[model samples]
Target: MTTRRSTLKLLAAGSLPAMLAMPAARAQQPLLRQLAIVVAFPAGGATDAVARLVADGLRGKYAETVIVENRVGGGGRIGAVHVKNAPADGSVMLFGPAFPMAIFPHIYKTLPYDPLTDFVPVATTSKGAFALSVGPAVPASVRSMADFVAWTKANPDKATFGAPPGGGQHFAGALFAKQAGIPLQMVPYKGGAPSVVDVLGGHIASVVTPLPEVLQHVKDGKLRMLATTTERRSPFTPEVPTMKELGWDVVFQDWSGFLAPARTPADVVARANAAIKEAVASPKVAAALQAQGTDVDINSPADFARLHRQTWERYRDVVRSTGFKAED
Candidate 1:
């Protein structure tokens, strides 16, 4: 018994040297190269703003150069494809909305790439609620959800609304139509800014879009908000009600985040995710997002991935329930 005990202790003592050397091996490797943040939307949009904020945060923590490149087109598919095909190194990251990750594939007939197979979800940085607003030409009495639904039902084809192509805004309108059991002719714009312009110009009856993009028009009375898309009213527009609270069936928001190519190194993903968490926690960045009526959500890479899968699954069901056929 004594000999066996001595032998076991000796064996245990010999393994300590190897365990100590393991950390040194990791330390010897070079730090990650400069990061390239790819934004699918055009510069000056919410996605661009969020990406720049994250990049600035990463710059504060890491010595590597961080560059944000806007690759706007095809409703994020183009930039998404660009990142998916790029080197799987930690250097290339995509900053955009959940559409590219979750909703796009279910909608389009032929997507350029497979979201699940091509990219890895890093984090869901922020989300902003959608607002139901009317142009200056509309009646102010149409402020409540009840009033808005009644008006749309009575007007029918007269209720022309504009939304970005194949986005949360479009789905918001569809859900609203489905709940109210009324038809709303939705006009498709390439982006939110154009739709905001059309609504403010009285070219459309109303516009359902992210609050940050259309808040200014609402403040200036060019547009009047009827309700928000969530179950709760936004603090930015506290007076506005919600579709669910009003007994409707629409819950939609514009959410943005980061994703890297699949098979990125664990160390690199960890480093990138750490930088992202720090960025979203920064007071300056939080304030900026809050000012735009966005809620910052900085989660670990694993949590973000879980949320990514959950959101995609939910929306996939929503898309399938809508019976929206694949567009050619």
Candidate 2:
């Protein structure tokens, strides 16, 4: 009896090792069957373009199939809410601008999703600065922000600037007008593309929009970039000066990145981060984004989270100072 008991004990002890190894082995398998990259804006926009590029890069990187979905409306809030309520299994991710994540919380009376608690920053895929551009209605001699301000003051009737409604670009124009001590009228467009269209048609004197949307027009001589919204000159437009350099306190840059629902498993987040970093670093992806005047900025999950927090606080103050409130 004693010998039999000893053998049974040894067998049970040996089985414990196999049981421990089972979970680790299963973890090596794919975490998801499919991956969805959700774009909060309409398709064919810059954000959607970047999301598709990353999706293409991640196609064969993992066993799961990748797809991009457009979840439009509410200035990106609708899509953000959908992702925030999604399963924490890393199957769903948000590829969107900074507004829904950082700026909306302060501007809106009640936001559906809490950016600080509802999502995890996976990686920042690209960054682009805004440009204060003047269309053909403005004289070619009005080349800089200083010159633009002087011209607006001289001709208040034609001092109108266009920007997307309730976006960073709107506030940038407002702040610029306030700082320059000019009564500049800001016309709100539904999106950047339409604003650019109006500016090209000479219906609007100037516009504050994403550099990429206006860069080609500037190159084509249809629009003139007075200054960029970055602290330094953009590499794509090295000749253009920054607003700070031109004695205006306006400096803003827009970023697009990936975010998963909060509480996703650490391993899944790590895998997604790796895939995004690789995608952002791919030559084809870099070239496509650069052609759009966007610079690649891949970061670790933790670093990206830190950046999100810092940017949130900075924009909170900005929104507060503007005293701008979105209608509930």
lDDT of each: 0.79, 0.84
- Highest lDDT: which candidate? 2
Question: Which residue pairs in model 1 clash with each other?
Answer: none
Compared with the true structure, model 1 gives a TM-score of: 0.86
Compose the digit string of candidate 1's lDDT tens values, residues 161-274: 787667777788887777677778789876677787888887888887778877777787778888888767888888878888888778876468888898987777877787
Candidate 2, pairs of clashing residues: none
Alpha-carbon lDDT of model 1: 0.79
Query: Which residue window of length 10 is worst by lDDT in model 1?
Result: 26-35
User: Among these predicted structures, which one has the highest TM-score?
Assistant: 2
In model 1, what lDDT does residue 253 have?
Answer: 67
Clashes of each: 0, 0
True-structure lDDT of candidate 2: 0.84
Q: Which stretches in model 1 have alpha-carbon errors above 4 Å?
A: 1-33
Model 1 clashing-pair count: 0
Question: What tens digits encode model 2's per-residue C-alpha lDDT throughout 63-118?
Answer: 36899998877878888989999999888999977877888888878989999999
